[model samples]
Every structure is written in structure tokens, then in C-alpha cells.
Target: MVTKSSSGEPSSPLSHTDVASGTTGEVVDTTTAPPAQGTAGAEVQQTPLNIAELNAPDGNAPVEINDDDDSFDGDSAIGSDVGSDTTSLTSSVLHYKYENGRTYHAFREGQYIMPNDDKEQDRLDLVHHVWRLILRGELHRAPISKTVQRVLDIGTGTGIWAMEFADEFRSTTVIANDLSPIQPTWVPPNLQFETDDAEDEWLYTQPFDYIHIRNMGASIADWPKLVTRSLENLQPGGWIEIQEHAIEMHSEDGEVPRNTVQWLSEMEGAARTFGKDMNVAKNLGGYLRDAGFEDVHVDKYKIPLGAWARDKRMKEIGRFQQAYRATGLPHII
Candidate 1:
């Protein structure tokens, strides 16, 4: 039951089937406001669903399982342990009854849920580009792995980057955390995923060398508090990386699309109504600097959607940008 806007782009109608297919990307502006009190959002308004409670009498769980459906090559990198971990995490975080064969844990705040479609594969490819850029010294100018001992990946959806990092640096311990534990468990001995809320008080004993948070604009309610927590968790001289897109407004050469920009602005308004801030990117550097992160570097790049750009690199960026935007609809609006 998906609809389209006046612009004729498809919009995701809220429905059970839409949740299952994960193809619902409807851009609408809702009326919600930011949370008023500090640490109030962390209080569980409703109890989360427990998978163990839904298991059959025969000790079997009723899951709408997809097999041999490796649309994303990174799925192959995740072994059986990771599979079990995904199921376990879903059981802990999700709080919905599956009408028909659809499961809903795949969609949650601060979680990277890829559509079970070809678009997801393209998104994974785009992620690889970011990784390559970082590895080849095209993205981050600082020494990434030289003195990094403990690495923290915030909002690690697929855990691919963390897994790859652990595989690359065998000696470094990588802790990947997300709101929804969708990451695989069978990662390198150095890598592990924890089920915890980022906004909640952290209880980790060890400090990390490098902390990374990507695409978390929609989920995090307080940007300054999040940066403060990161700084508290990081060791002296350690680095924290924050990656996000310009959601409310974006353009090539700063020339934005009127309709697209309007839609994004409406979406941001909706997020504000829902007790979240949609403008995390603009405040990232300021938050970092305020938190005492030295040598802070910020870079912005135009990521086009569709094949609308003439530059070869821009076109490639568009392909990835489309996937990123497609998966991001739920969070924004």
C-alpha cells in the first residue's frame, strides 16, 4: 500500500507488507516535536519484544527466513554465528507481532536496515567505496590504524566495516554497537557487538583509541551529549569520526533542487516533531570542538541521486547516494 507524491515519486504507505519488503520510502512531513527533558527519551516508553517468548512449543521460532539470498556480498563475510546474533538481537529489540510472514526488527531507530531488494546490493557496493576511500588515504588524512588499539564503531548496522577492520588489524579490539543488534556474531576474535542504547549512560571500563559513528542523524536526540559521551570514552589523543549527509538540504555546487529540498525540509520538521534533530551534520564539528577533540577535520561532498550528474565520479556517487537515501526514508520522515 505505497503511494506517490505530487512529484510522482513513490511513497511508502504505512502497512505490514511494506515493512516486510522494506521498499517503502515515502517522503512526508509529520508534526512531531523534539523531546523536552534530558535523559527522558532513554526511559523505555514501551516494553521491547522478546523473541524467546514467541518460540513454538517445539523450541522452534517462527521467522520469515530468507536463504540463499545473498544480495549483499558482505553477507557472505558474516558466518553462522553472526546469523544467530542477528536473530538474538532482533528478539531483544523488536516489539511487534508479525501478521503474515513479515518481521519488523529490521527497522528501528539508529539501525541500518537494508531493503531486501537489488537496491540493497548497490548500497553495499557504495559502502565499499567509502571503505576504499578511507583505506587509500583519499578520505581521512590522519593516521587511522597506526596507534589505534581499541576501535568503537557507533551505529554499526551490518558490522562490515568493523569486521573488515578487525580482520585487517588482527591486534586491535573492535567494539561495534547499534540500537538494533543486526550485526553478525562470528566476527574476528577482536570484534564484537553489544546491545545497548547510545544515549544511555555507558559503563565500559576501557577507553577506545578511535570511535566512529556514521549515518546516525535521525536516531540520536542530543548531539552534544553524544559527543560528550564519546569524549569520555576516548583516550587522550584518540580520534572520533562522525559521518552524515545533509538531509534537510543538499545540492551540487550549493545549488539545491527546490522540490527535493522542500521534501527534505518537511521531513526534518517531522523528525523534530518526533523528538529528534535532523541537523546533526552542521553541528558535528562544533560538537567535536566543544568536546575537546583536537585536530578536528570536516569535509563535505555532493552526493547526487540518480544519474543526474555529468561527472563520471559524480554519477558513481549518485548510485550510492540513491541507495543511501532510499534506506534513510524511515528515519527522516
Candidate 2:
């Protein structure tokens, strides 16, 4: 199938196995691309949640958040109760690896550095809550009608988003695939999970009405090829949505601690050592347009680092982000 090159010109046809076999064309140097400019940072406001109270003494008991909070539904925000059951691929995919006392997926070993153990699964669900809050409880930002036919979710960690999306759009057939077969068998009738690698060629028999990719900034080796593959696998007038974040910390006053800066720099360098980029979030829009998409729109939201927002919703978002980042930093970096 024909795909766009780094220069936005039509490139020659790519074989189905080009990306997975590492036989693709030139890689896009995102570092050389000029930095994106816009409103400097995320807007912050006040909130009513008390950080100290949430982490109070006496074994740090759980606190009950108000159900009417504008941010997210208290109990319904997380995914359905996941059972220990797995897909039919369990026999081959169950060979998990262990390192430093942590478990990781054995399928496509070493491709994705992050662990897929229970701890990591919990973190994934927590981040899913953060996403729902950020989107104001919507499944996606793409302005597609509910009657869309088919959907695809790449890098479906824990399959939380995919499960919820399938439940919301019962008429649409949804396919969620990831490196690990960790998804629960108890899912909506419309949803199905698979064990697959997105970096490889997409051999989907039919095109999808919408393709959703999230939190894949550090897992892809060739972004251009991925964009091209998504383009080729999409039906005409289909929509593809990407949700990602730049892996750098910023302050409004141009002042950051030296140690923090150094740590972030080292983390980025580590990702490069594995042939991935942690800062592809800002460049996704350009990639889509260059791949021949006519209408491309971007919405950027800045999530604060802690419970420092004046708005209650923003504070909760920041608090959740703090937990999510802390849980991921040690393993991912």
C-alpha cells in the first residue's frame, strides 16, 4: 500500500511486513522539527479535595469522594470488574518474565519495557480514570456519529477503554489488541480482544470507521509507518484519534530545578536507547495531515503535576496525574 514519506510526498508501495521487519524508509527526525507554540500551560483553578486527608494516618484508609463531583463518577469511572479469565491465547502468552521482582509480558519480549503485572494493570486503570476526567466522560473527541460501523484501538493496555467504548457503542464492532492477552473474557458482546503488535503490518481484513491510539508515544519505532498504516486501513472519511503527552516538565516562569531537568533528560535518553520517542505527542497532527488527511484538528490540555489547582476538578486531575506518573516513572524510565 502507498504511504506518505517524511516530506509529505507519496512514497512507493510498502509490503505488509515492512515495519515489523525493520525494512522501512527514512525515519522522521522529530527533534529537528521546530517546537510547537500555543498557550504556554494548562489552565489551573482551585479544588476542594484535601491531599493530606486522602493520605491521612491510620493505615491510610480509603476516602469516599462525592458522586456528584463534576470531574468523574466515583465508582463507575473505572472499568468493569475484571476476572482472572483470559483469552484463548493464554497458553502461549502466559509465559511472563520476571526481573528485579517484577513480572512482565513474555509475548514480544523486551519490545515494551513497561511491566504488565498486576501493579502495572492497576496503574493502567488509574490512568484510564484520568483520561475519562480529562475528556469529561466522553469516549473520544472525534466528531463521529454513533452509527459508525467498526472501530480499532491500538495498544489496548488492560482493555479498559476498549471495554467502555464497546459498551457505549453497542452497534459498532470493536477490536482491541495489545502485546499481552490480559483482557478479561467477561466483556460486552460487541467487544473482542486480541494479542497483536501494532508496529507490525496491519493485516486487518476490513477497514474501520474509527481508529483510536493512546499512550503509544514510547512504544513505536517508526511513527511515519504507523500513520501510513492507519491511513491505509481506514475507510474513506474515517476518523483516527491519538491521545498523548510530551514527556517533559515545564514551568510557566522558565524556572525548573536542576536535578529534575537532569532526570527528565536522562529519561528521554533512555527511551532513545530503545529506539522510541517520548515526545511524539505534539507532532501527531502534522503526521496525520501529511498522510493526506484533509481536516486535522488538535486539542491540547495541560494536566498539572499535583493538587495545586484552585478548581476542584483541576485539583483532582492533578492529584490523579501525580499518582499515575509516580507509578510509571520507575519502570518506564
Candidate 3:
């Protein structure tokens, strides 16, 4: 169930009618610190991350990203492969529309609940930036080699991560799929954006060496099936990495405002009525294990809800993140 936050906003990620889910890590500020004027927010700040820092573990020198273009001439269709008779992408051009004071996806209609306008895009970029900082600039934690071939990024919002990955690894083919074709037209030739749904059957000519999923907690209806498909489509010894966090408001000291609790209770009740579980992240590991994934590992990180950190960078990051949660959650709720 979703919990109360100072913002009085929903505490879940995008919604999956079946389950629910966070930020950089696990959390709470318990030093008897007075709660912020509001409940709690899982916001992320805009972080400046570079490809050089990600490639060099020694921090030896910055590796400039090669933004050169390539010519693949392969199938650029995202969902429902083109050559395959049984697979075909919906040829509808999704437009953007405004509703209830927020922007929304007009292409696939309500296939996704989050807005795709500039406001939400900024938040998505900020969320991406914060995670780069939390993960220390690395794109992913998959145990793969430098010699990667085909790579797929599911729900590639804005295609920022995919563009960066393509820029960093010019030799690798990166296919970024999303429900809306909102990515910039100019990008590395190695990277291509396609309009597709991750929940649907994946169609591609070749198998991928690495599959990456992030911040899709509220978008998927059946995560286990997705994982099973990942396992089936991946080449031998391939690895799929999932990054997720919890949404419930937590505190080590257990000091919470009763009013906030009341607020959270009511909000959760509404979510329950809608058939969306706000506690989805708690079961991700179980889903991976149930899908027959070997050596599945889950890492936990506790992120502060606001600018309550003692660390200089974390504190700055926390402030931006707080703004992100405030601005972004409304689009989803």
C-alpha cells in the first residue's frame, strides 16, 4: 500500500494494475529532526555525469564520447518486428495532450499514466541524473565484458541513457524502445529509438548480450513474465539487470505526524480501490528468482527524502530530488 508523504502525493511509481514500487536507496532521517513541512518526497536532482568517468575505474583520464554516426539499415521498428509476419507495430502517431493540470501521453492513450511533456521530462532526466550519481556514474551493474554486441534498453524515456550508451560504445548496437517516439532525432547511428511496449512480445533479429531495466515499477503488469522473456531471449550466459526501490515513507526513529498517516491512509485506500498495489518493489527479488534466474542479487540503498543529508553532494542532490518528487508525482497520480 502507498503511504503518506508530506506532499500529499501518491507514494508509488507509475502504476501497474497488479503491483506497485523509489529512489537511490532505502531511507529515513531519524535524528529527532522535525519532519519537513510536508510528508516525504522521493525526489532526484539533476546530476552532471560523463561517459569518461563511467569507463575508467582508475579515474585516470576522461574518455571523450564518440558521437559519430553509423549506418545499420536494420529494422528500426520497436515492437512487433517488421520482417516477421506475426509481428507489427501500431502505426498510430501518438500526440501529446493536457488534462487535469498535467500533460499526458496521447499516443497510446492510457497505456502509460505518466506525462511526457517538458515538466515530466525534466523530472525523468533528474531522476536519471541522481541514479547516475548513486550508482557512481556507471550505466549498469551487469557482469558483462567490454565487448558487447546488441543491447536493449526497455522503457527508454527521452532516450538519454541509450544515447549516452551509444556514444560511449560506438561499436555496440543499442535499441531503445518506448511507447512514445519522443526521443531526439539526432543520435548516434549505433543507437536507434523505436515505439514499442516492454509488456508485449519482444521481436528482434538477434539476441542481446545485455538487457537493462530501470524505474519501471509502475508500468509493468506482469513482471515475472517479462523476466521469463528476458531469460528466453538472452544469449547463453547473458545478464539482465533490474534497478528498483521502495516507495513507502520510512523513518529509523519512527517519528511520523499523525496527520500525515491519516493522509497516507486515505490515499492508499483510493489506490487499492483502483486495483494498484503501492508496495511492488518489495517483491522484485522474488520475481527474479521465480523466473529461474540464477545468482540473482538485490542491492539496497537508503536515500533521504529531502535535503537532510550531512554529505555535501548528497545534500545538494537531495534538494533537487525533493523538487523532482513534488513536480513529478502529480503527473502520475
Clashes of each: 7, 9, 12
The local distance difference test score of each candidate is: 0.50, 0.63, 0.55
**Model 1 over residues 1-333: C-alpha lDDT tens digits?**
011112232244322112222211111111111111122223322212233422212211121212232121112221222342445544546553242342324335323222322233335445546434323323332345444688888777666667777887788888988655556656799888886778889888987766777667777888889888887776655567776655533322223334554565776787787667766777777777776665555544433343344444533443444455555454323
After superposition, which runs of candidate 1 have C-alpha atoms over 4 Å from their true positions? 1-91, 94-102, 106-142, 248-257, 327-333
Residue pairs in clash, model 1: 12-26, 32-273, 32-274, 33-273, 34-275, 82-184, 82-185
Which candidate, 1 or 2, would have the higher TM-score against the true structure? 2
Number of residue pairs clashing in candidate 2, backbone atoms closer than 3 angstroms, sequence gap of 3 or more or interchain: 9
Candidate 3 C-alpha lDDT tens digits along 43-155: 32212223342232221112221124111121211221111111243444454567876656656577677777656666677767766765667777655556778888988
Off by over 4 Å in 3: 1-91, 258-278
Task: Give residue 322's lDDT in candidate 2 (0 to 100).
Answer: 57
The pairs that clash in candidate 2 are 45-309, 45-310, 45-311, 46-310, 46-311, 46-312, 47-310, 47-311, 47-312
As for lDDT, the candidate ahead, 2 or 3, is: 2
Reference-based lDDT, residue 314, model 3: 50
Q: Could you give me the TM-score of model 1 versus the true structure?
A: 0.64
lDDT of 2 at 236: 63
Q: Candidate 2's residue-wise lDDT over 80-153, tens digit each?
A: 35544585775757888889888787888989988887778878888888878767777776766678789999
Each prediction's RMSD to truth: 15.5, 16.5, 15.3
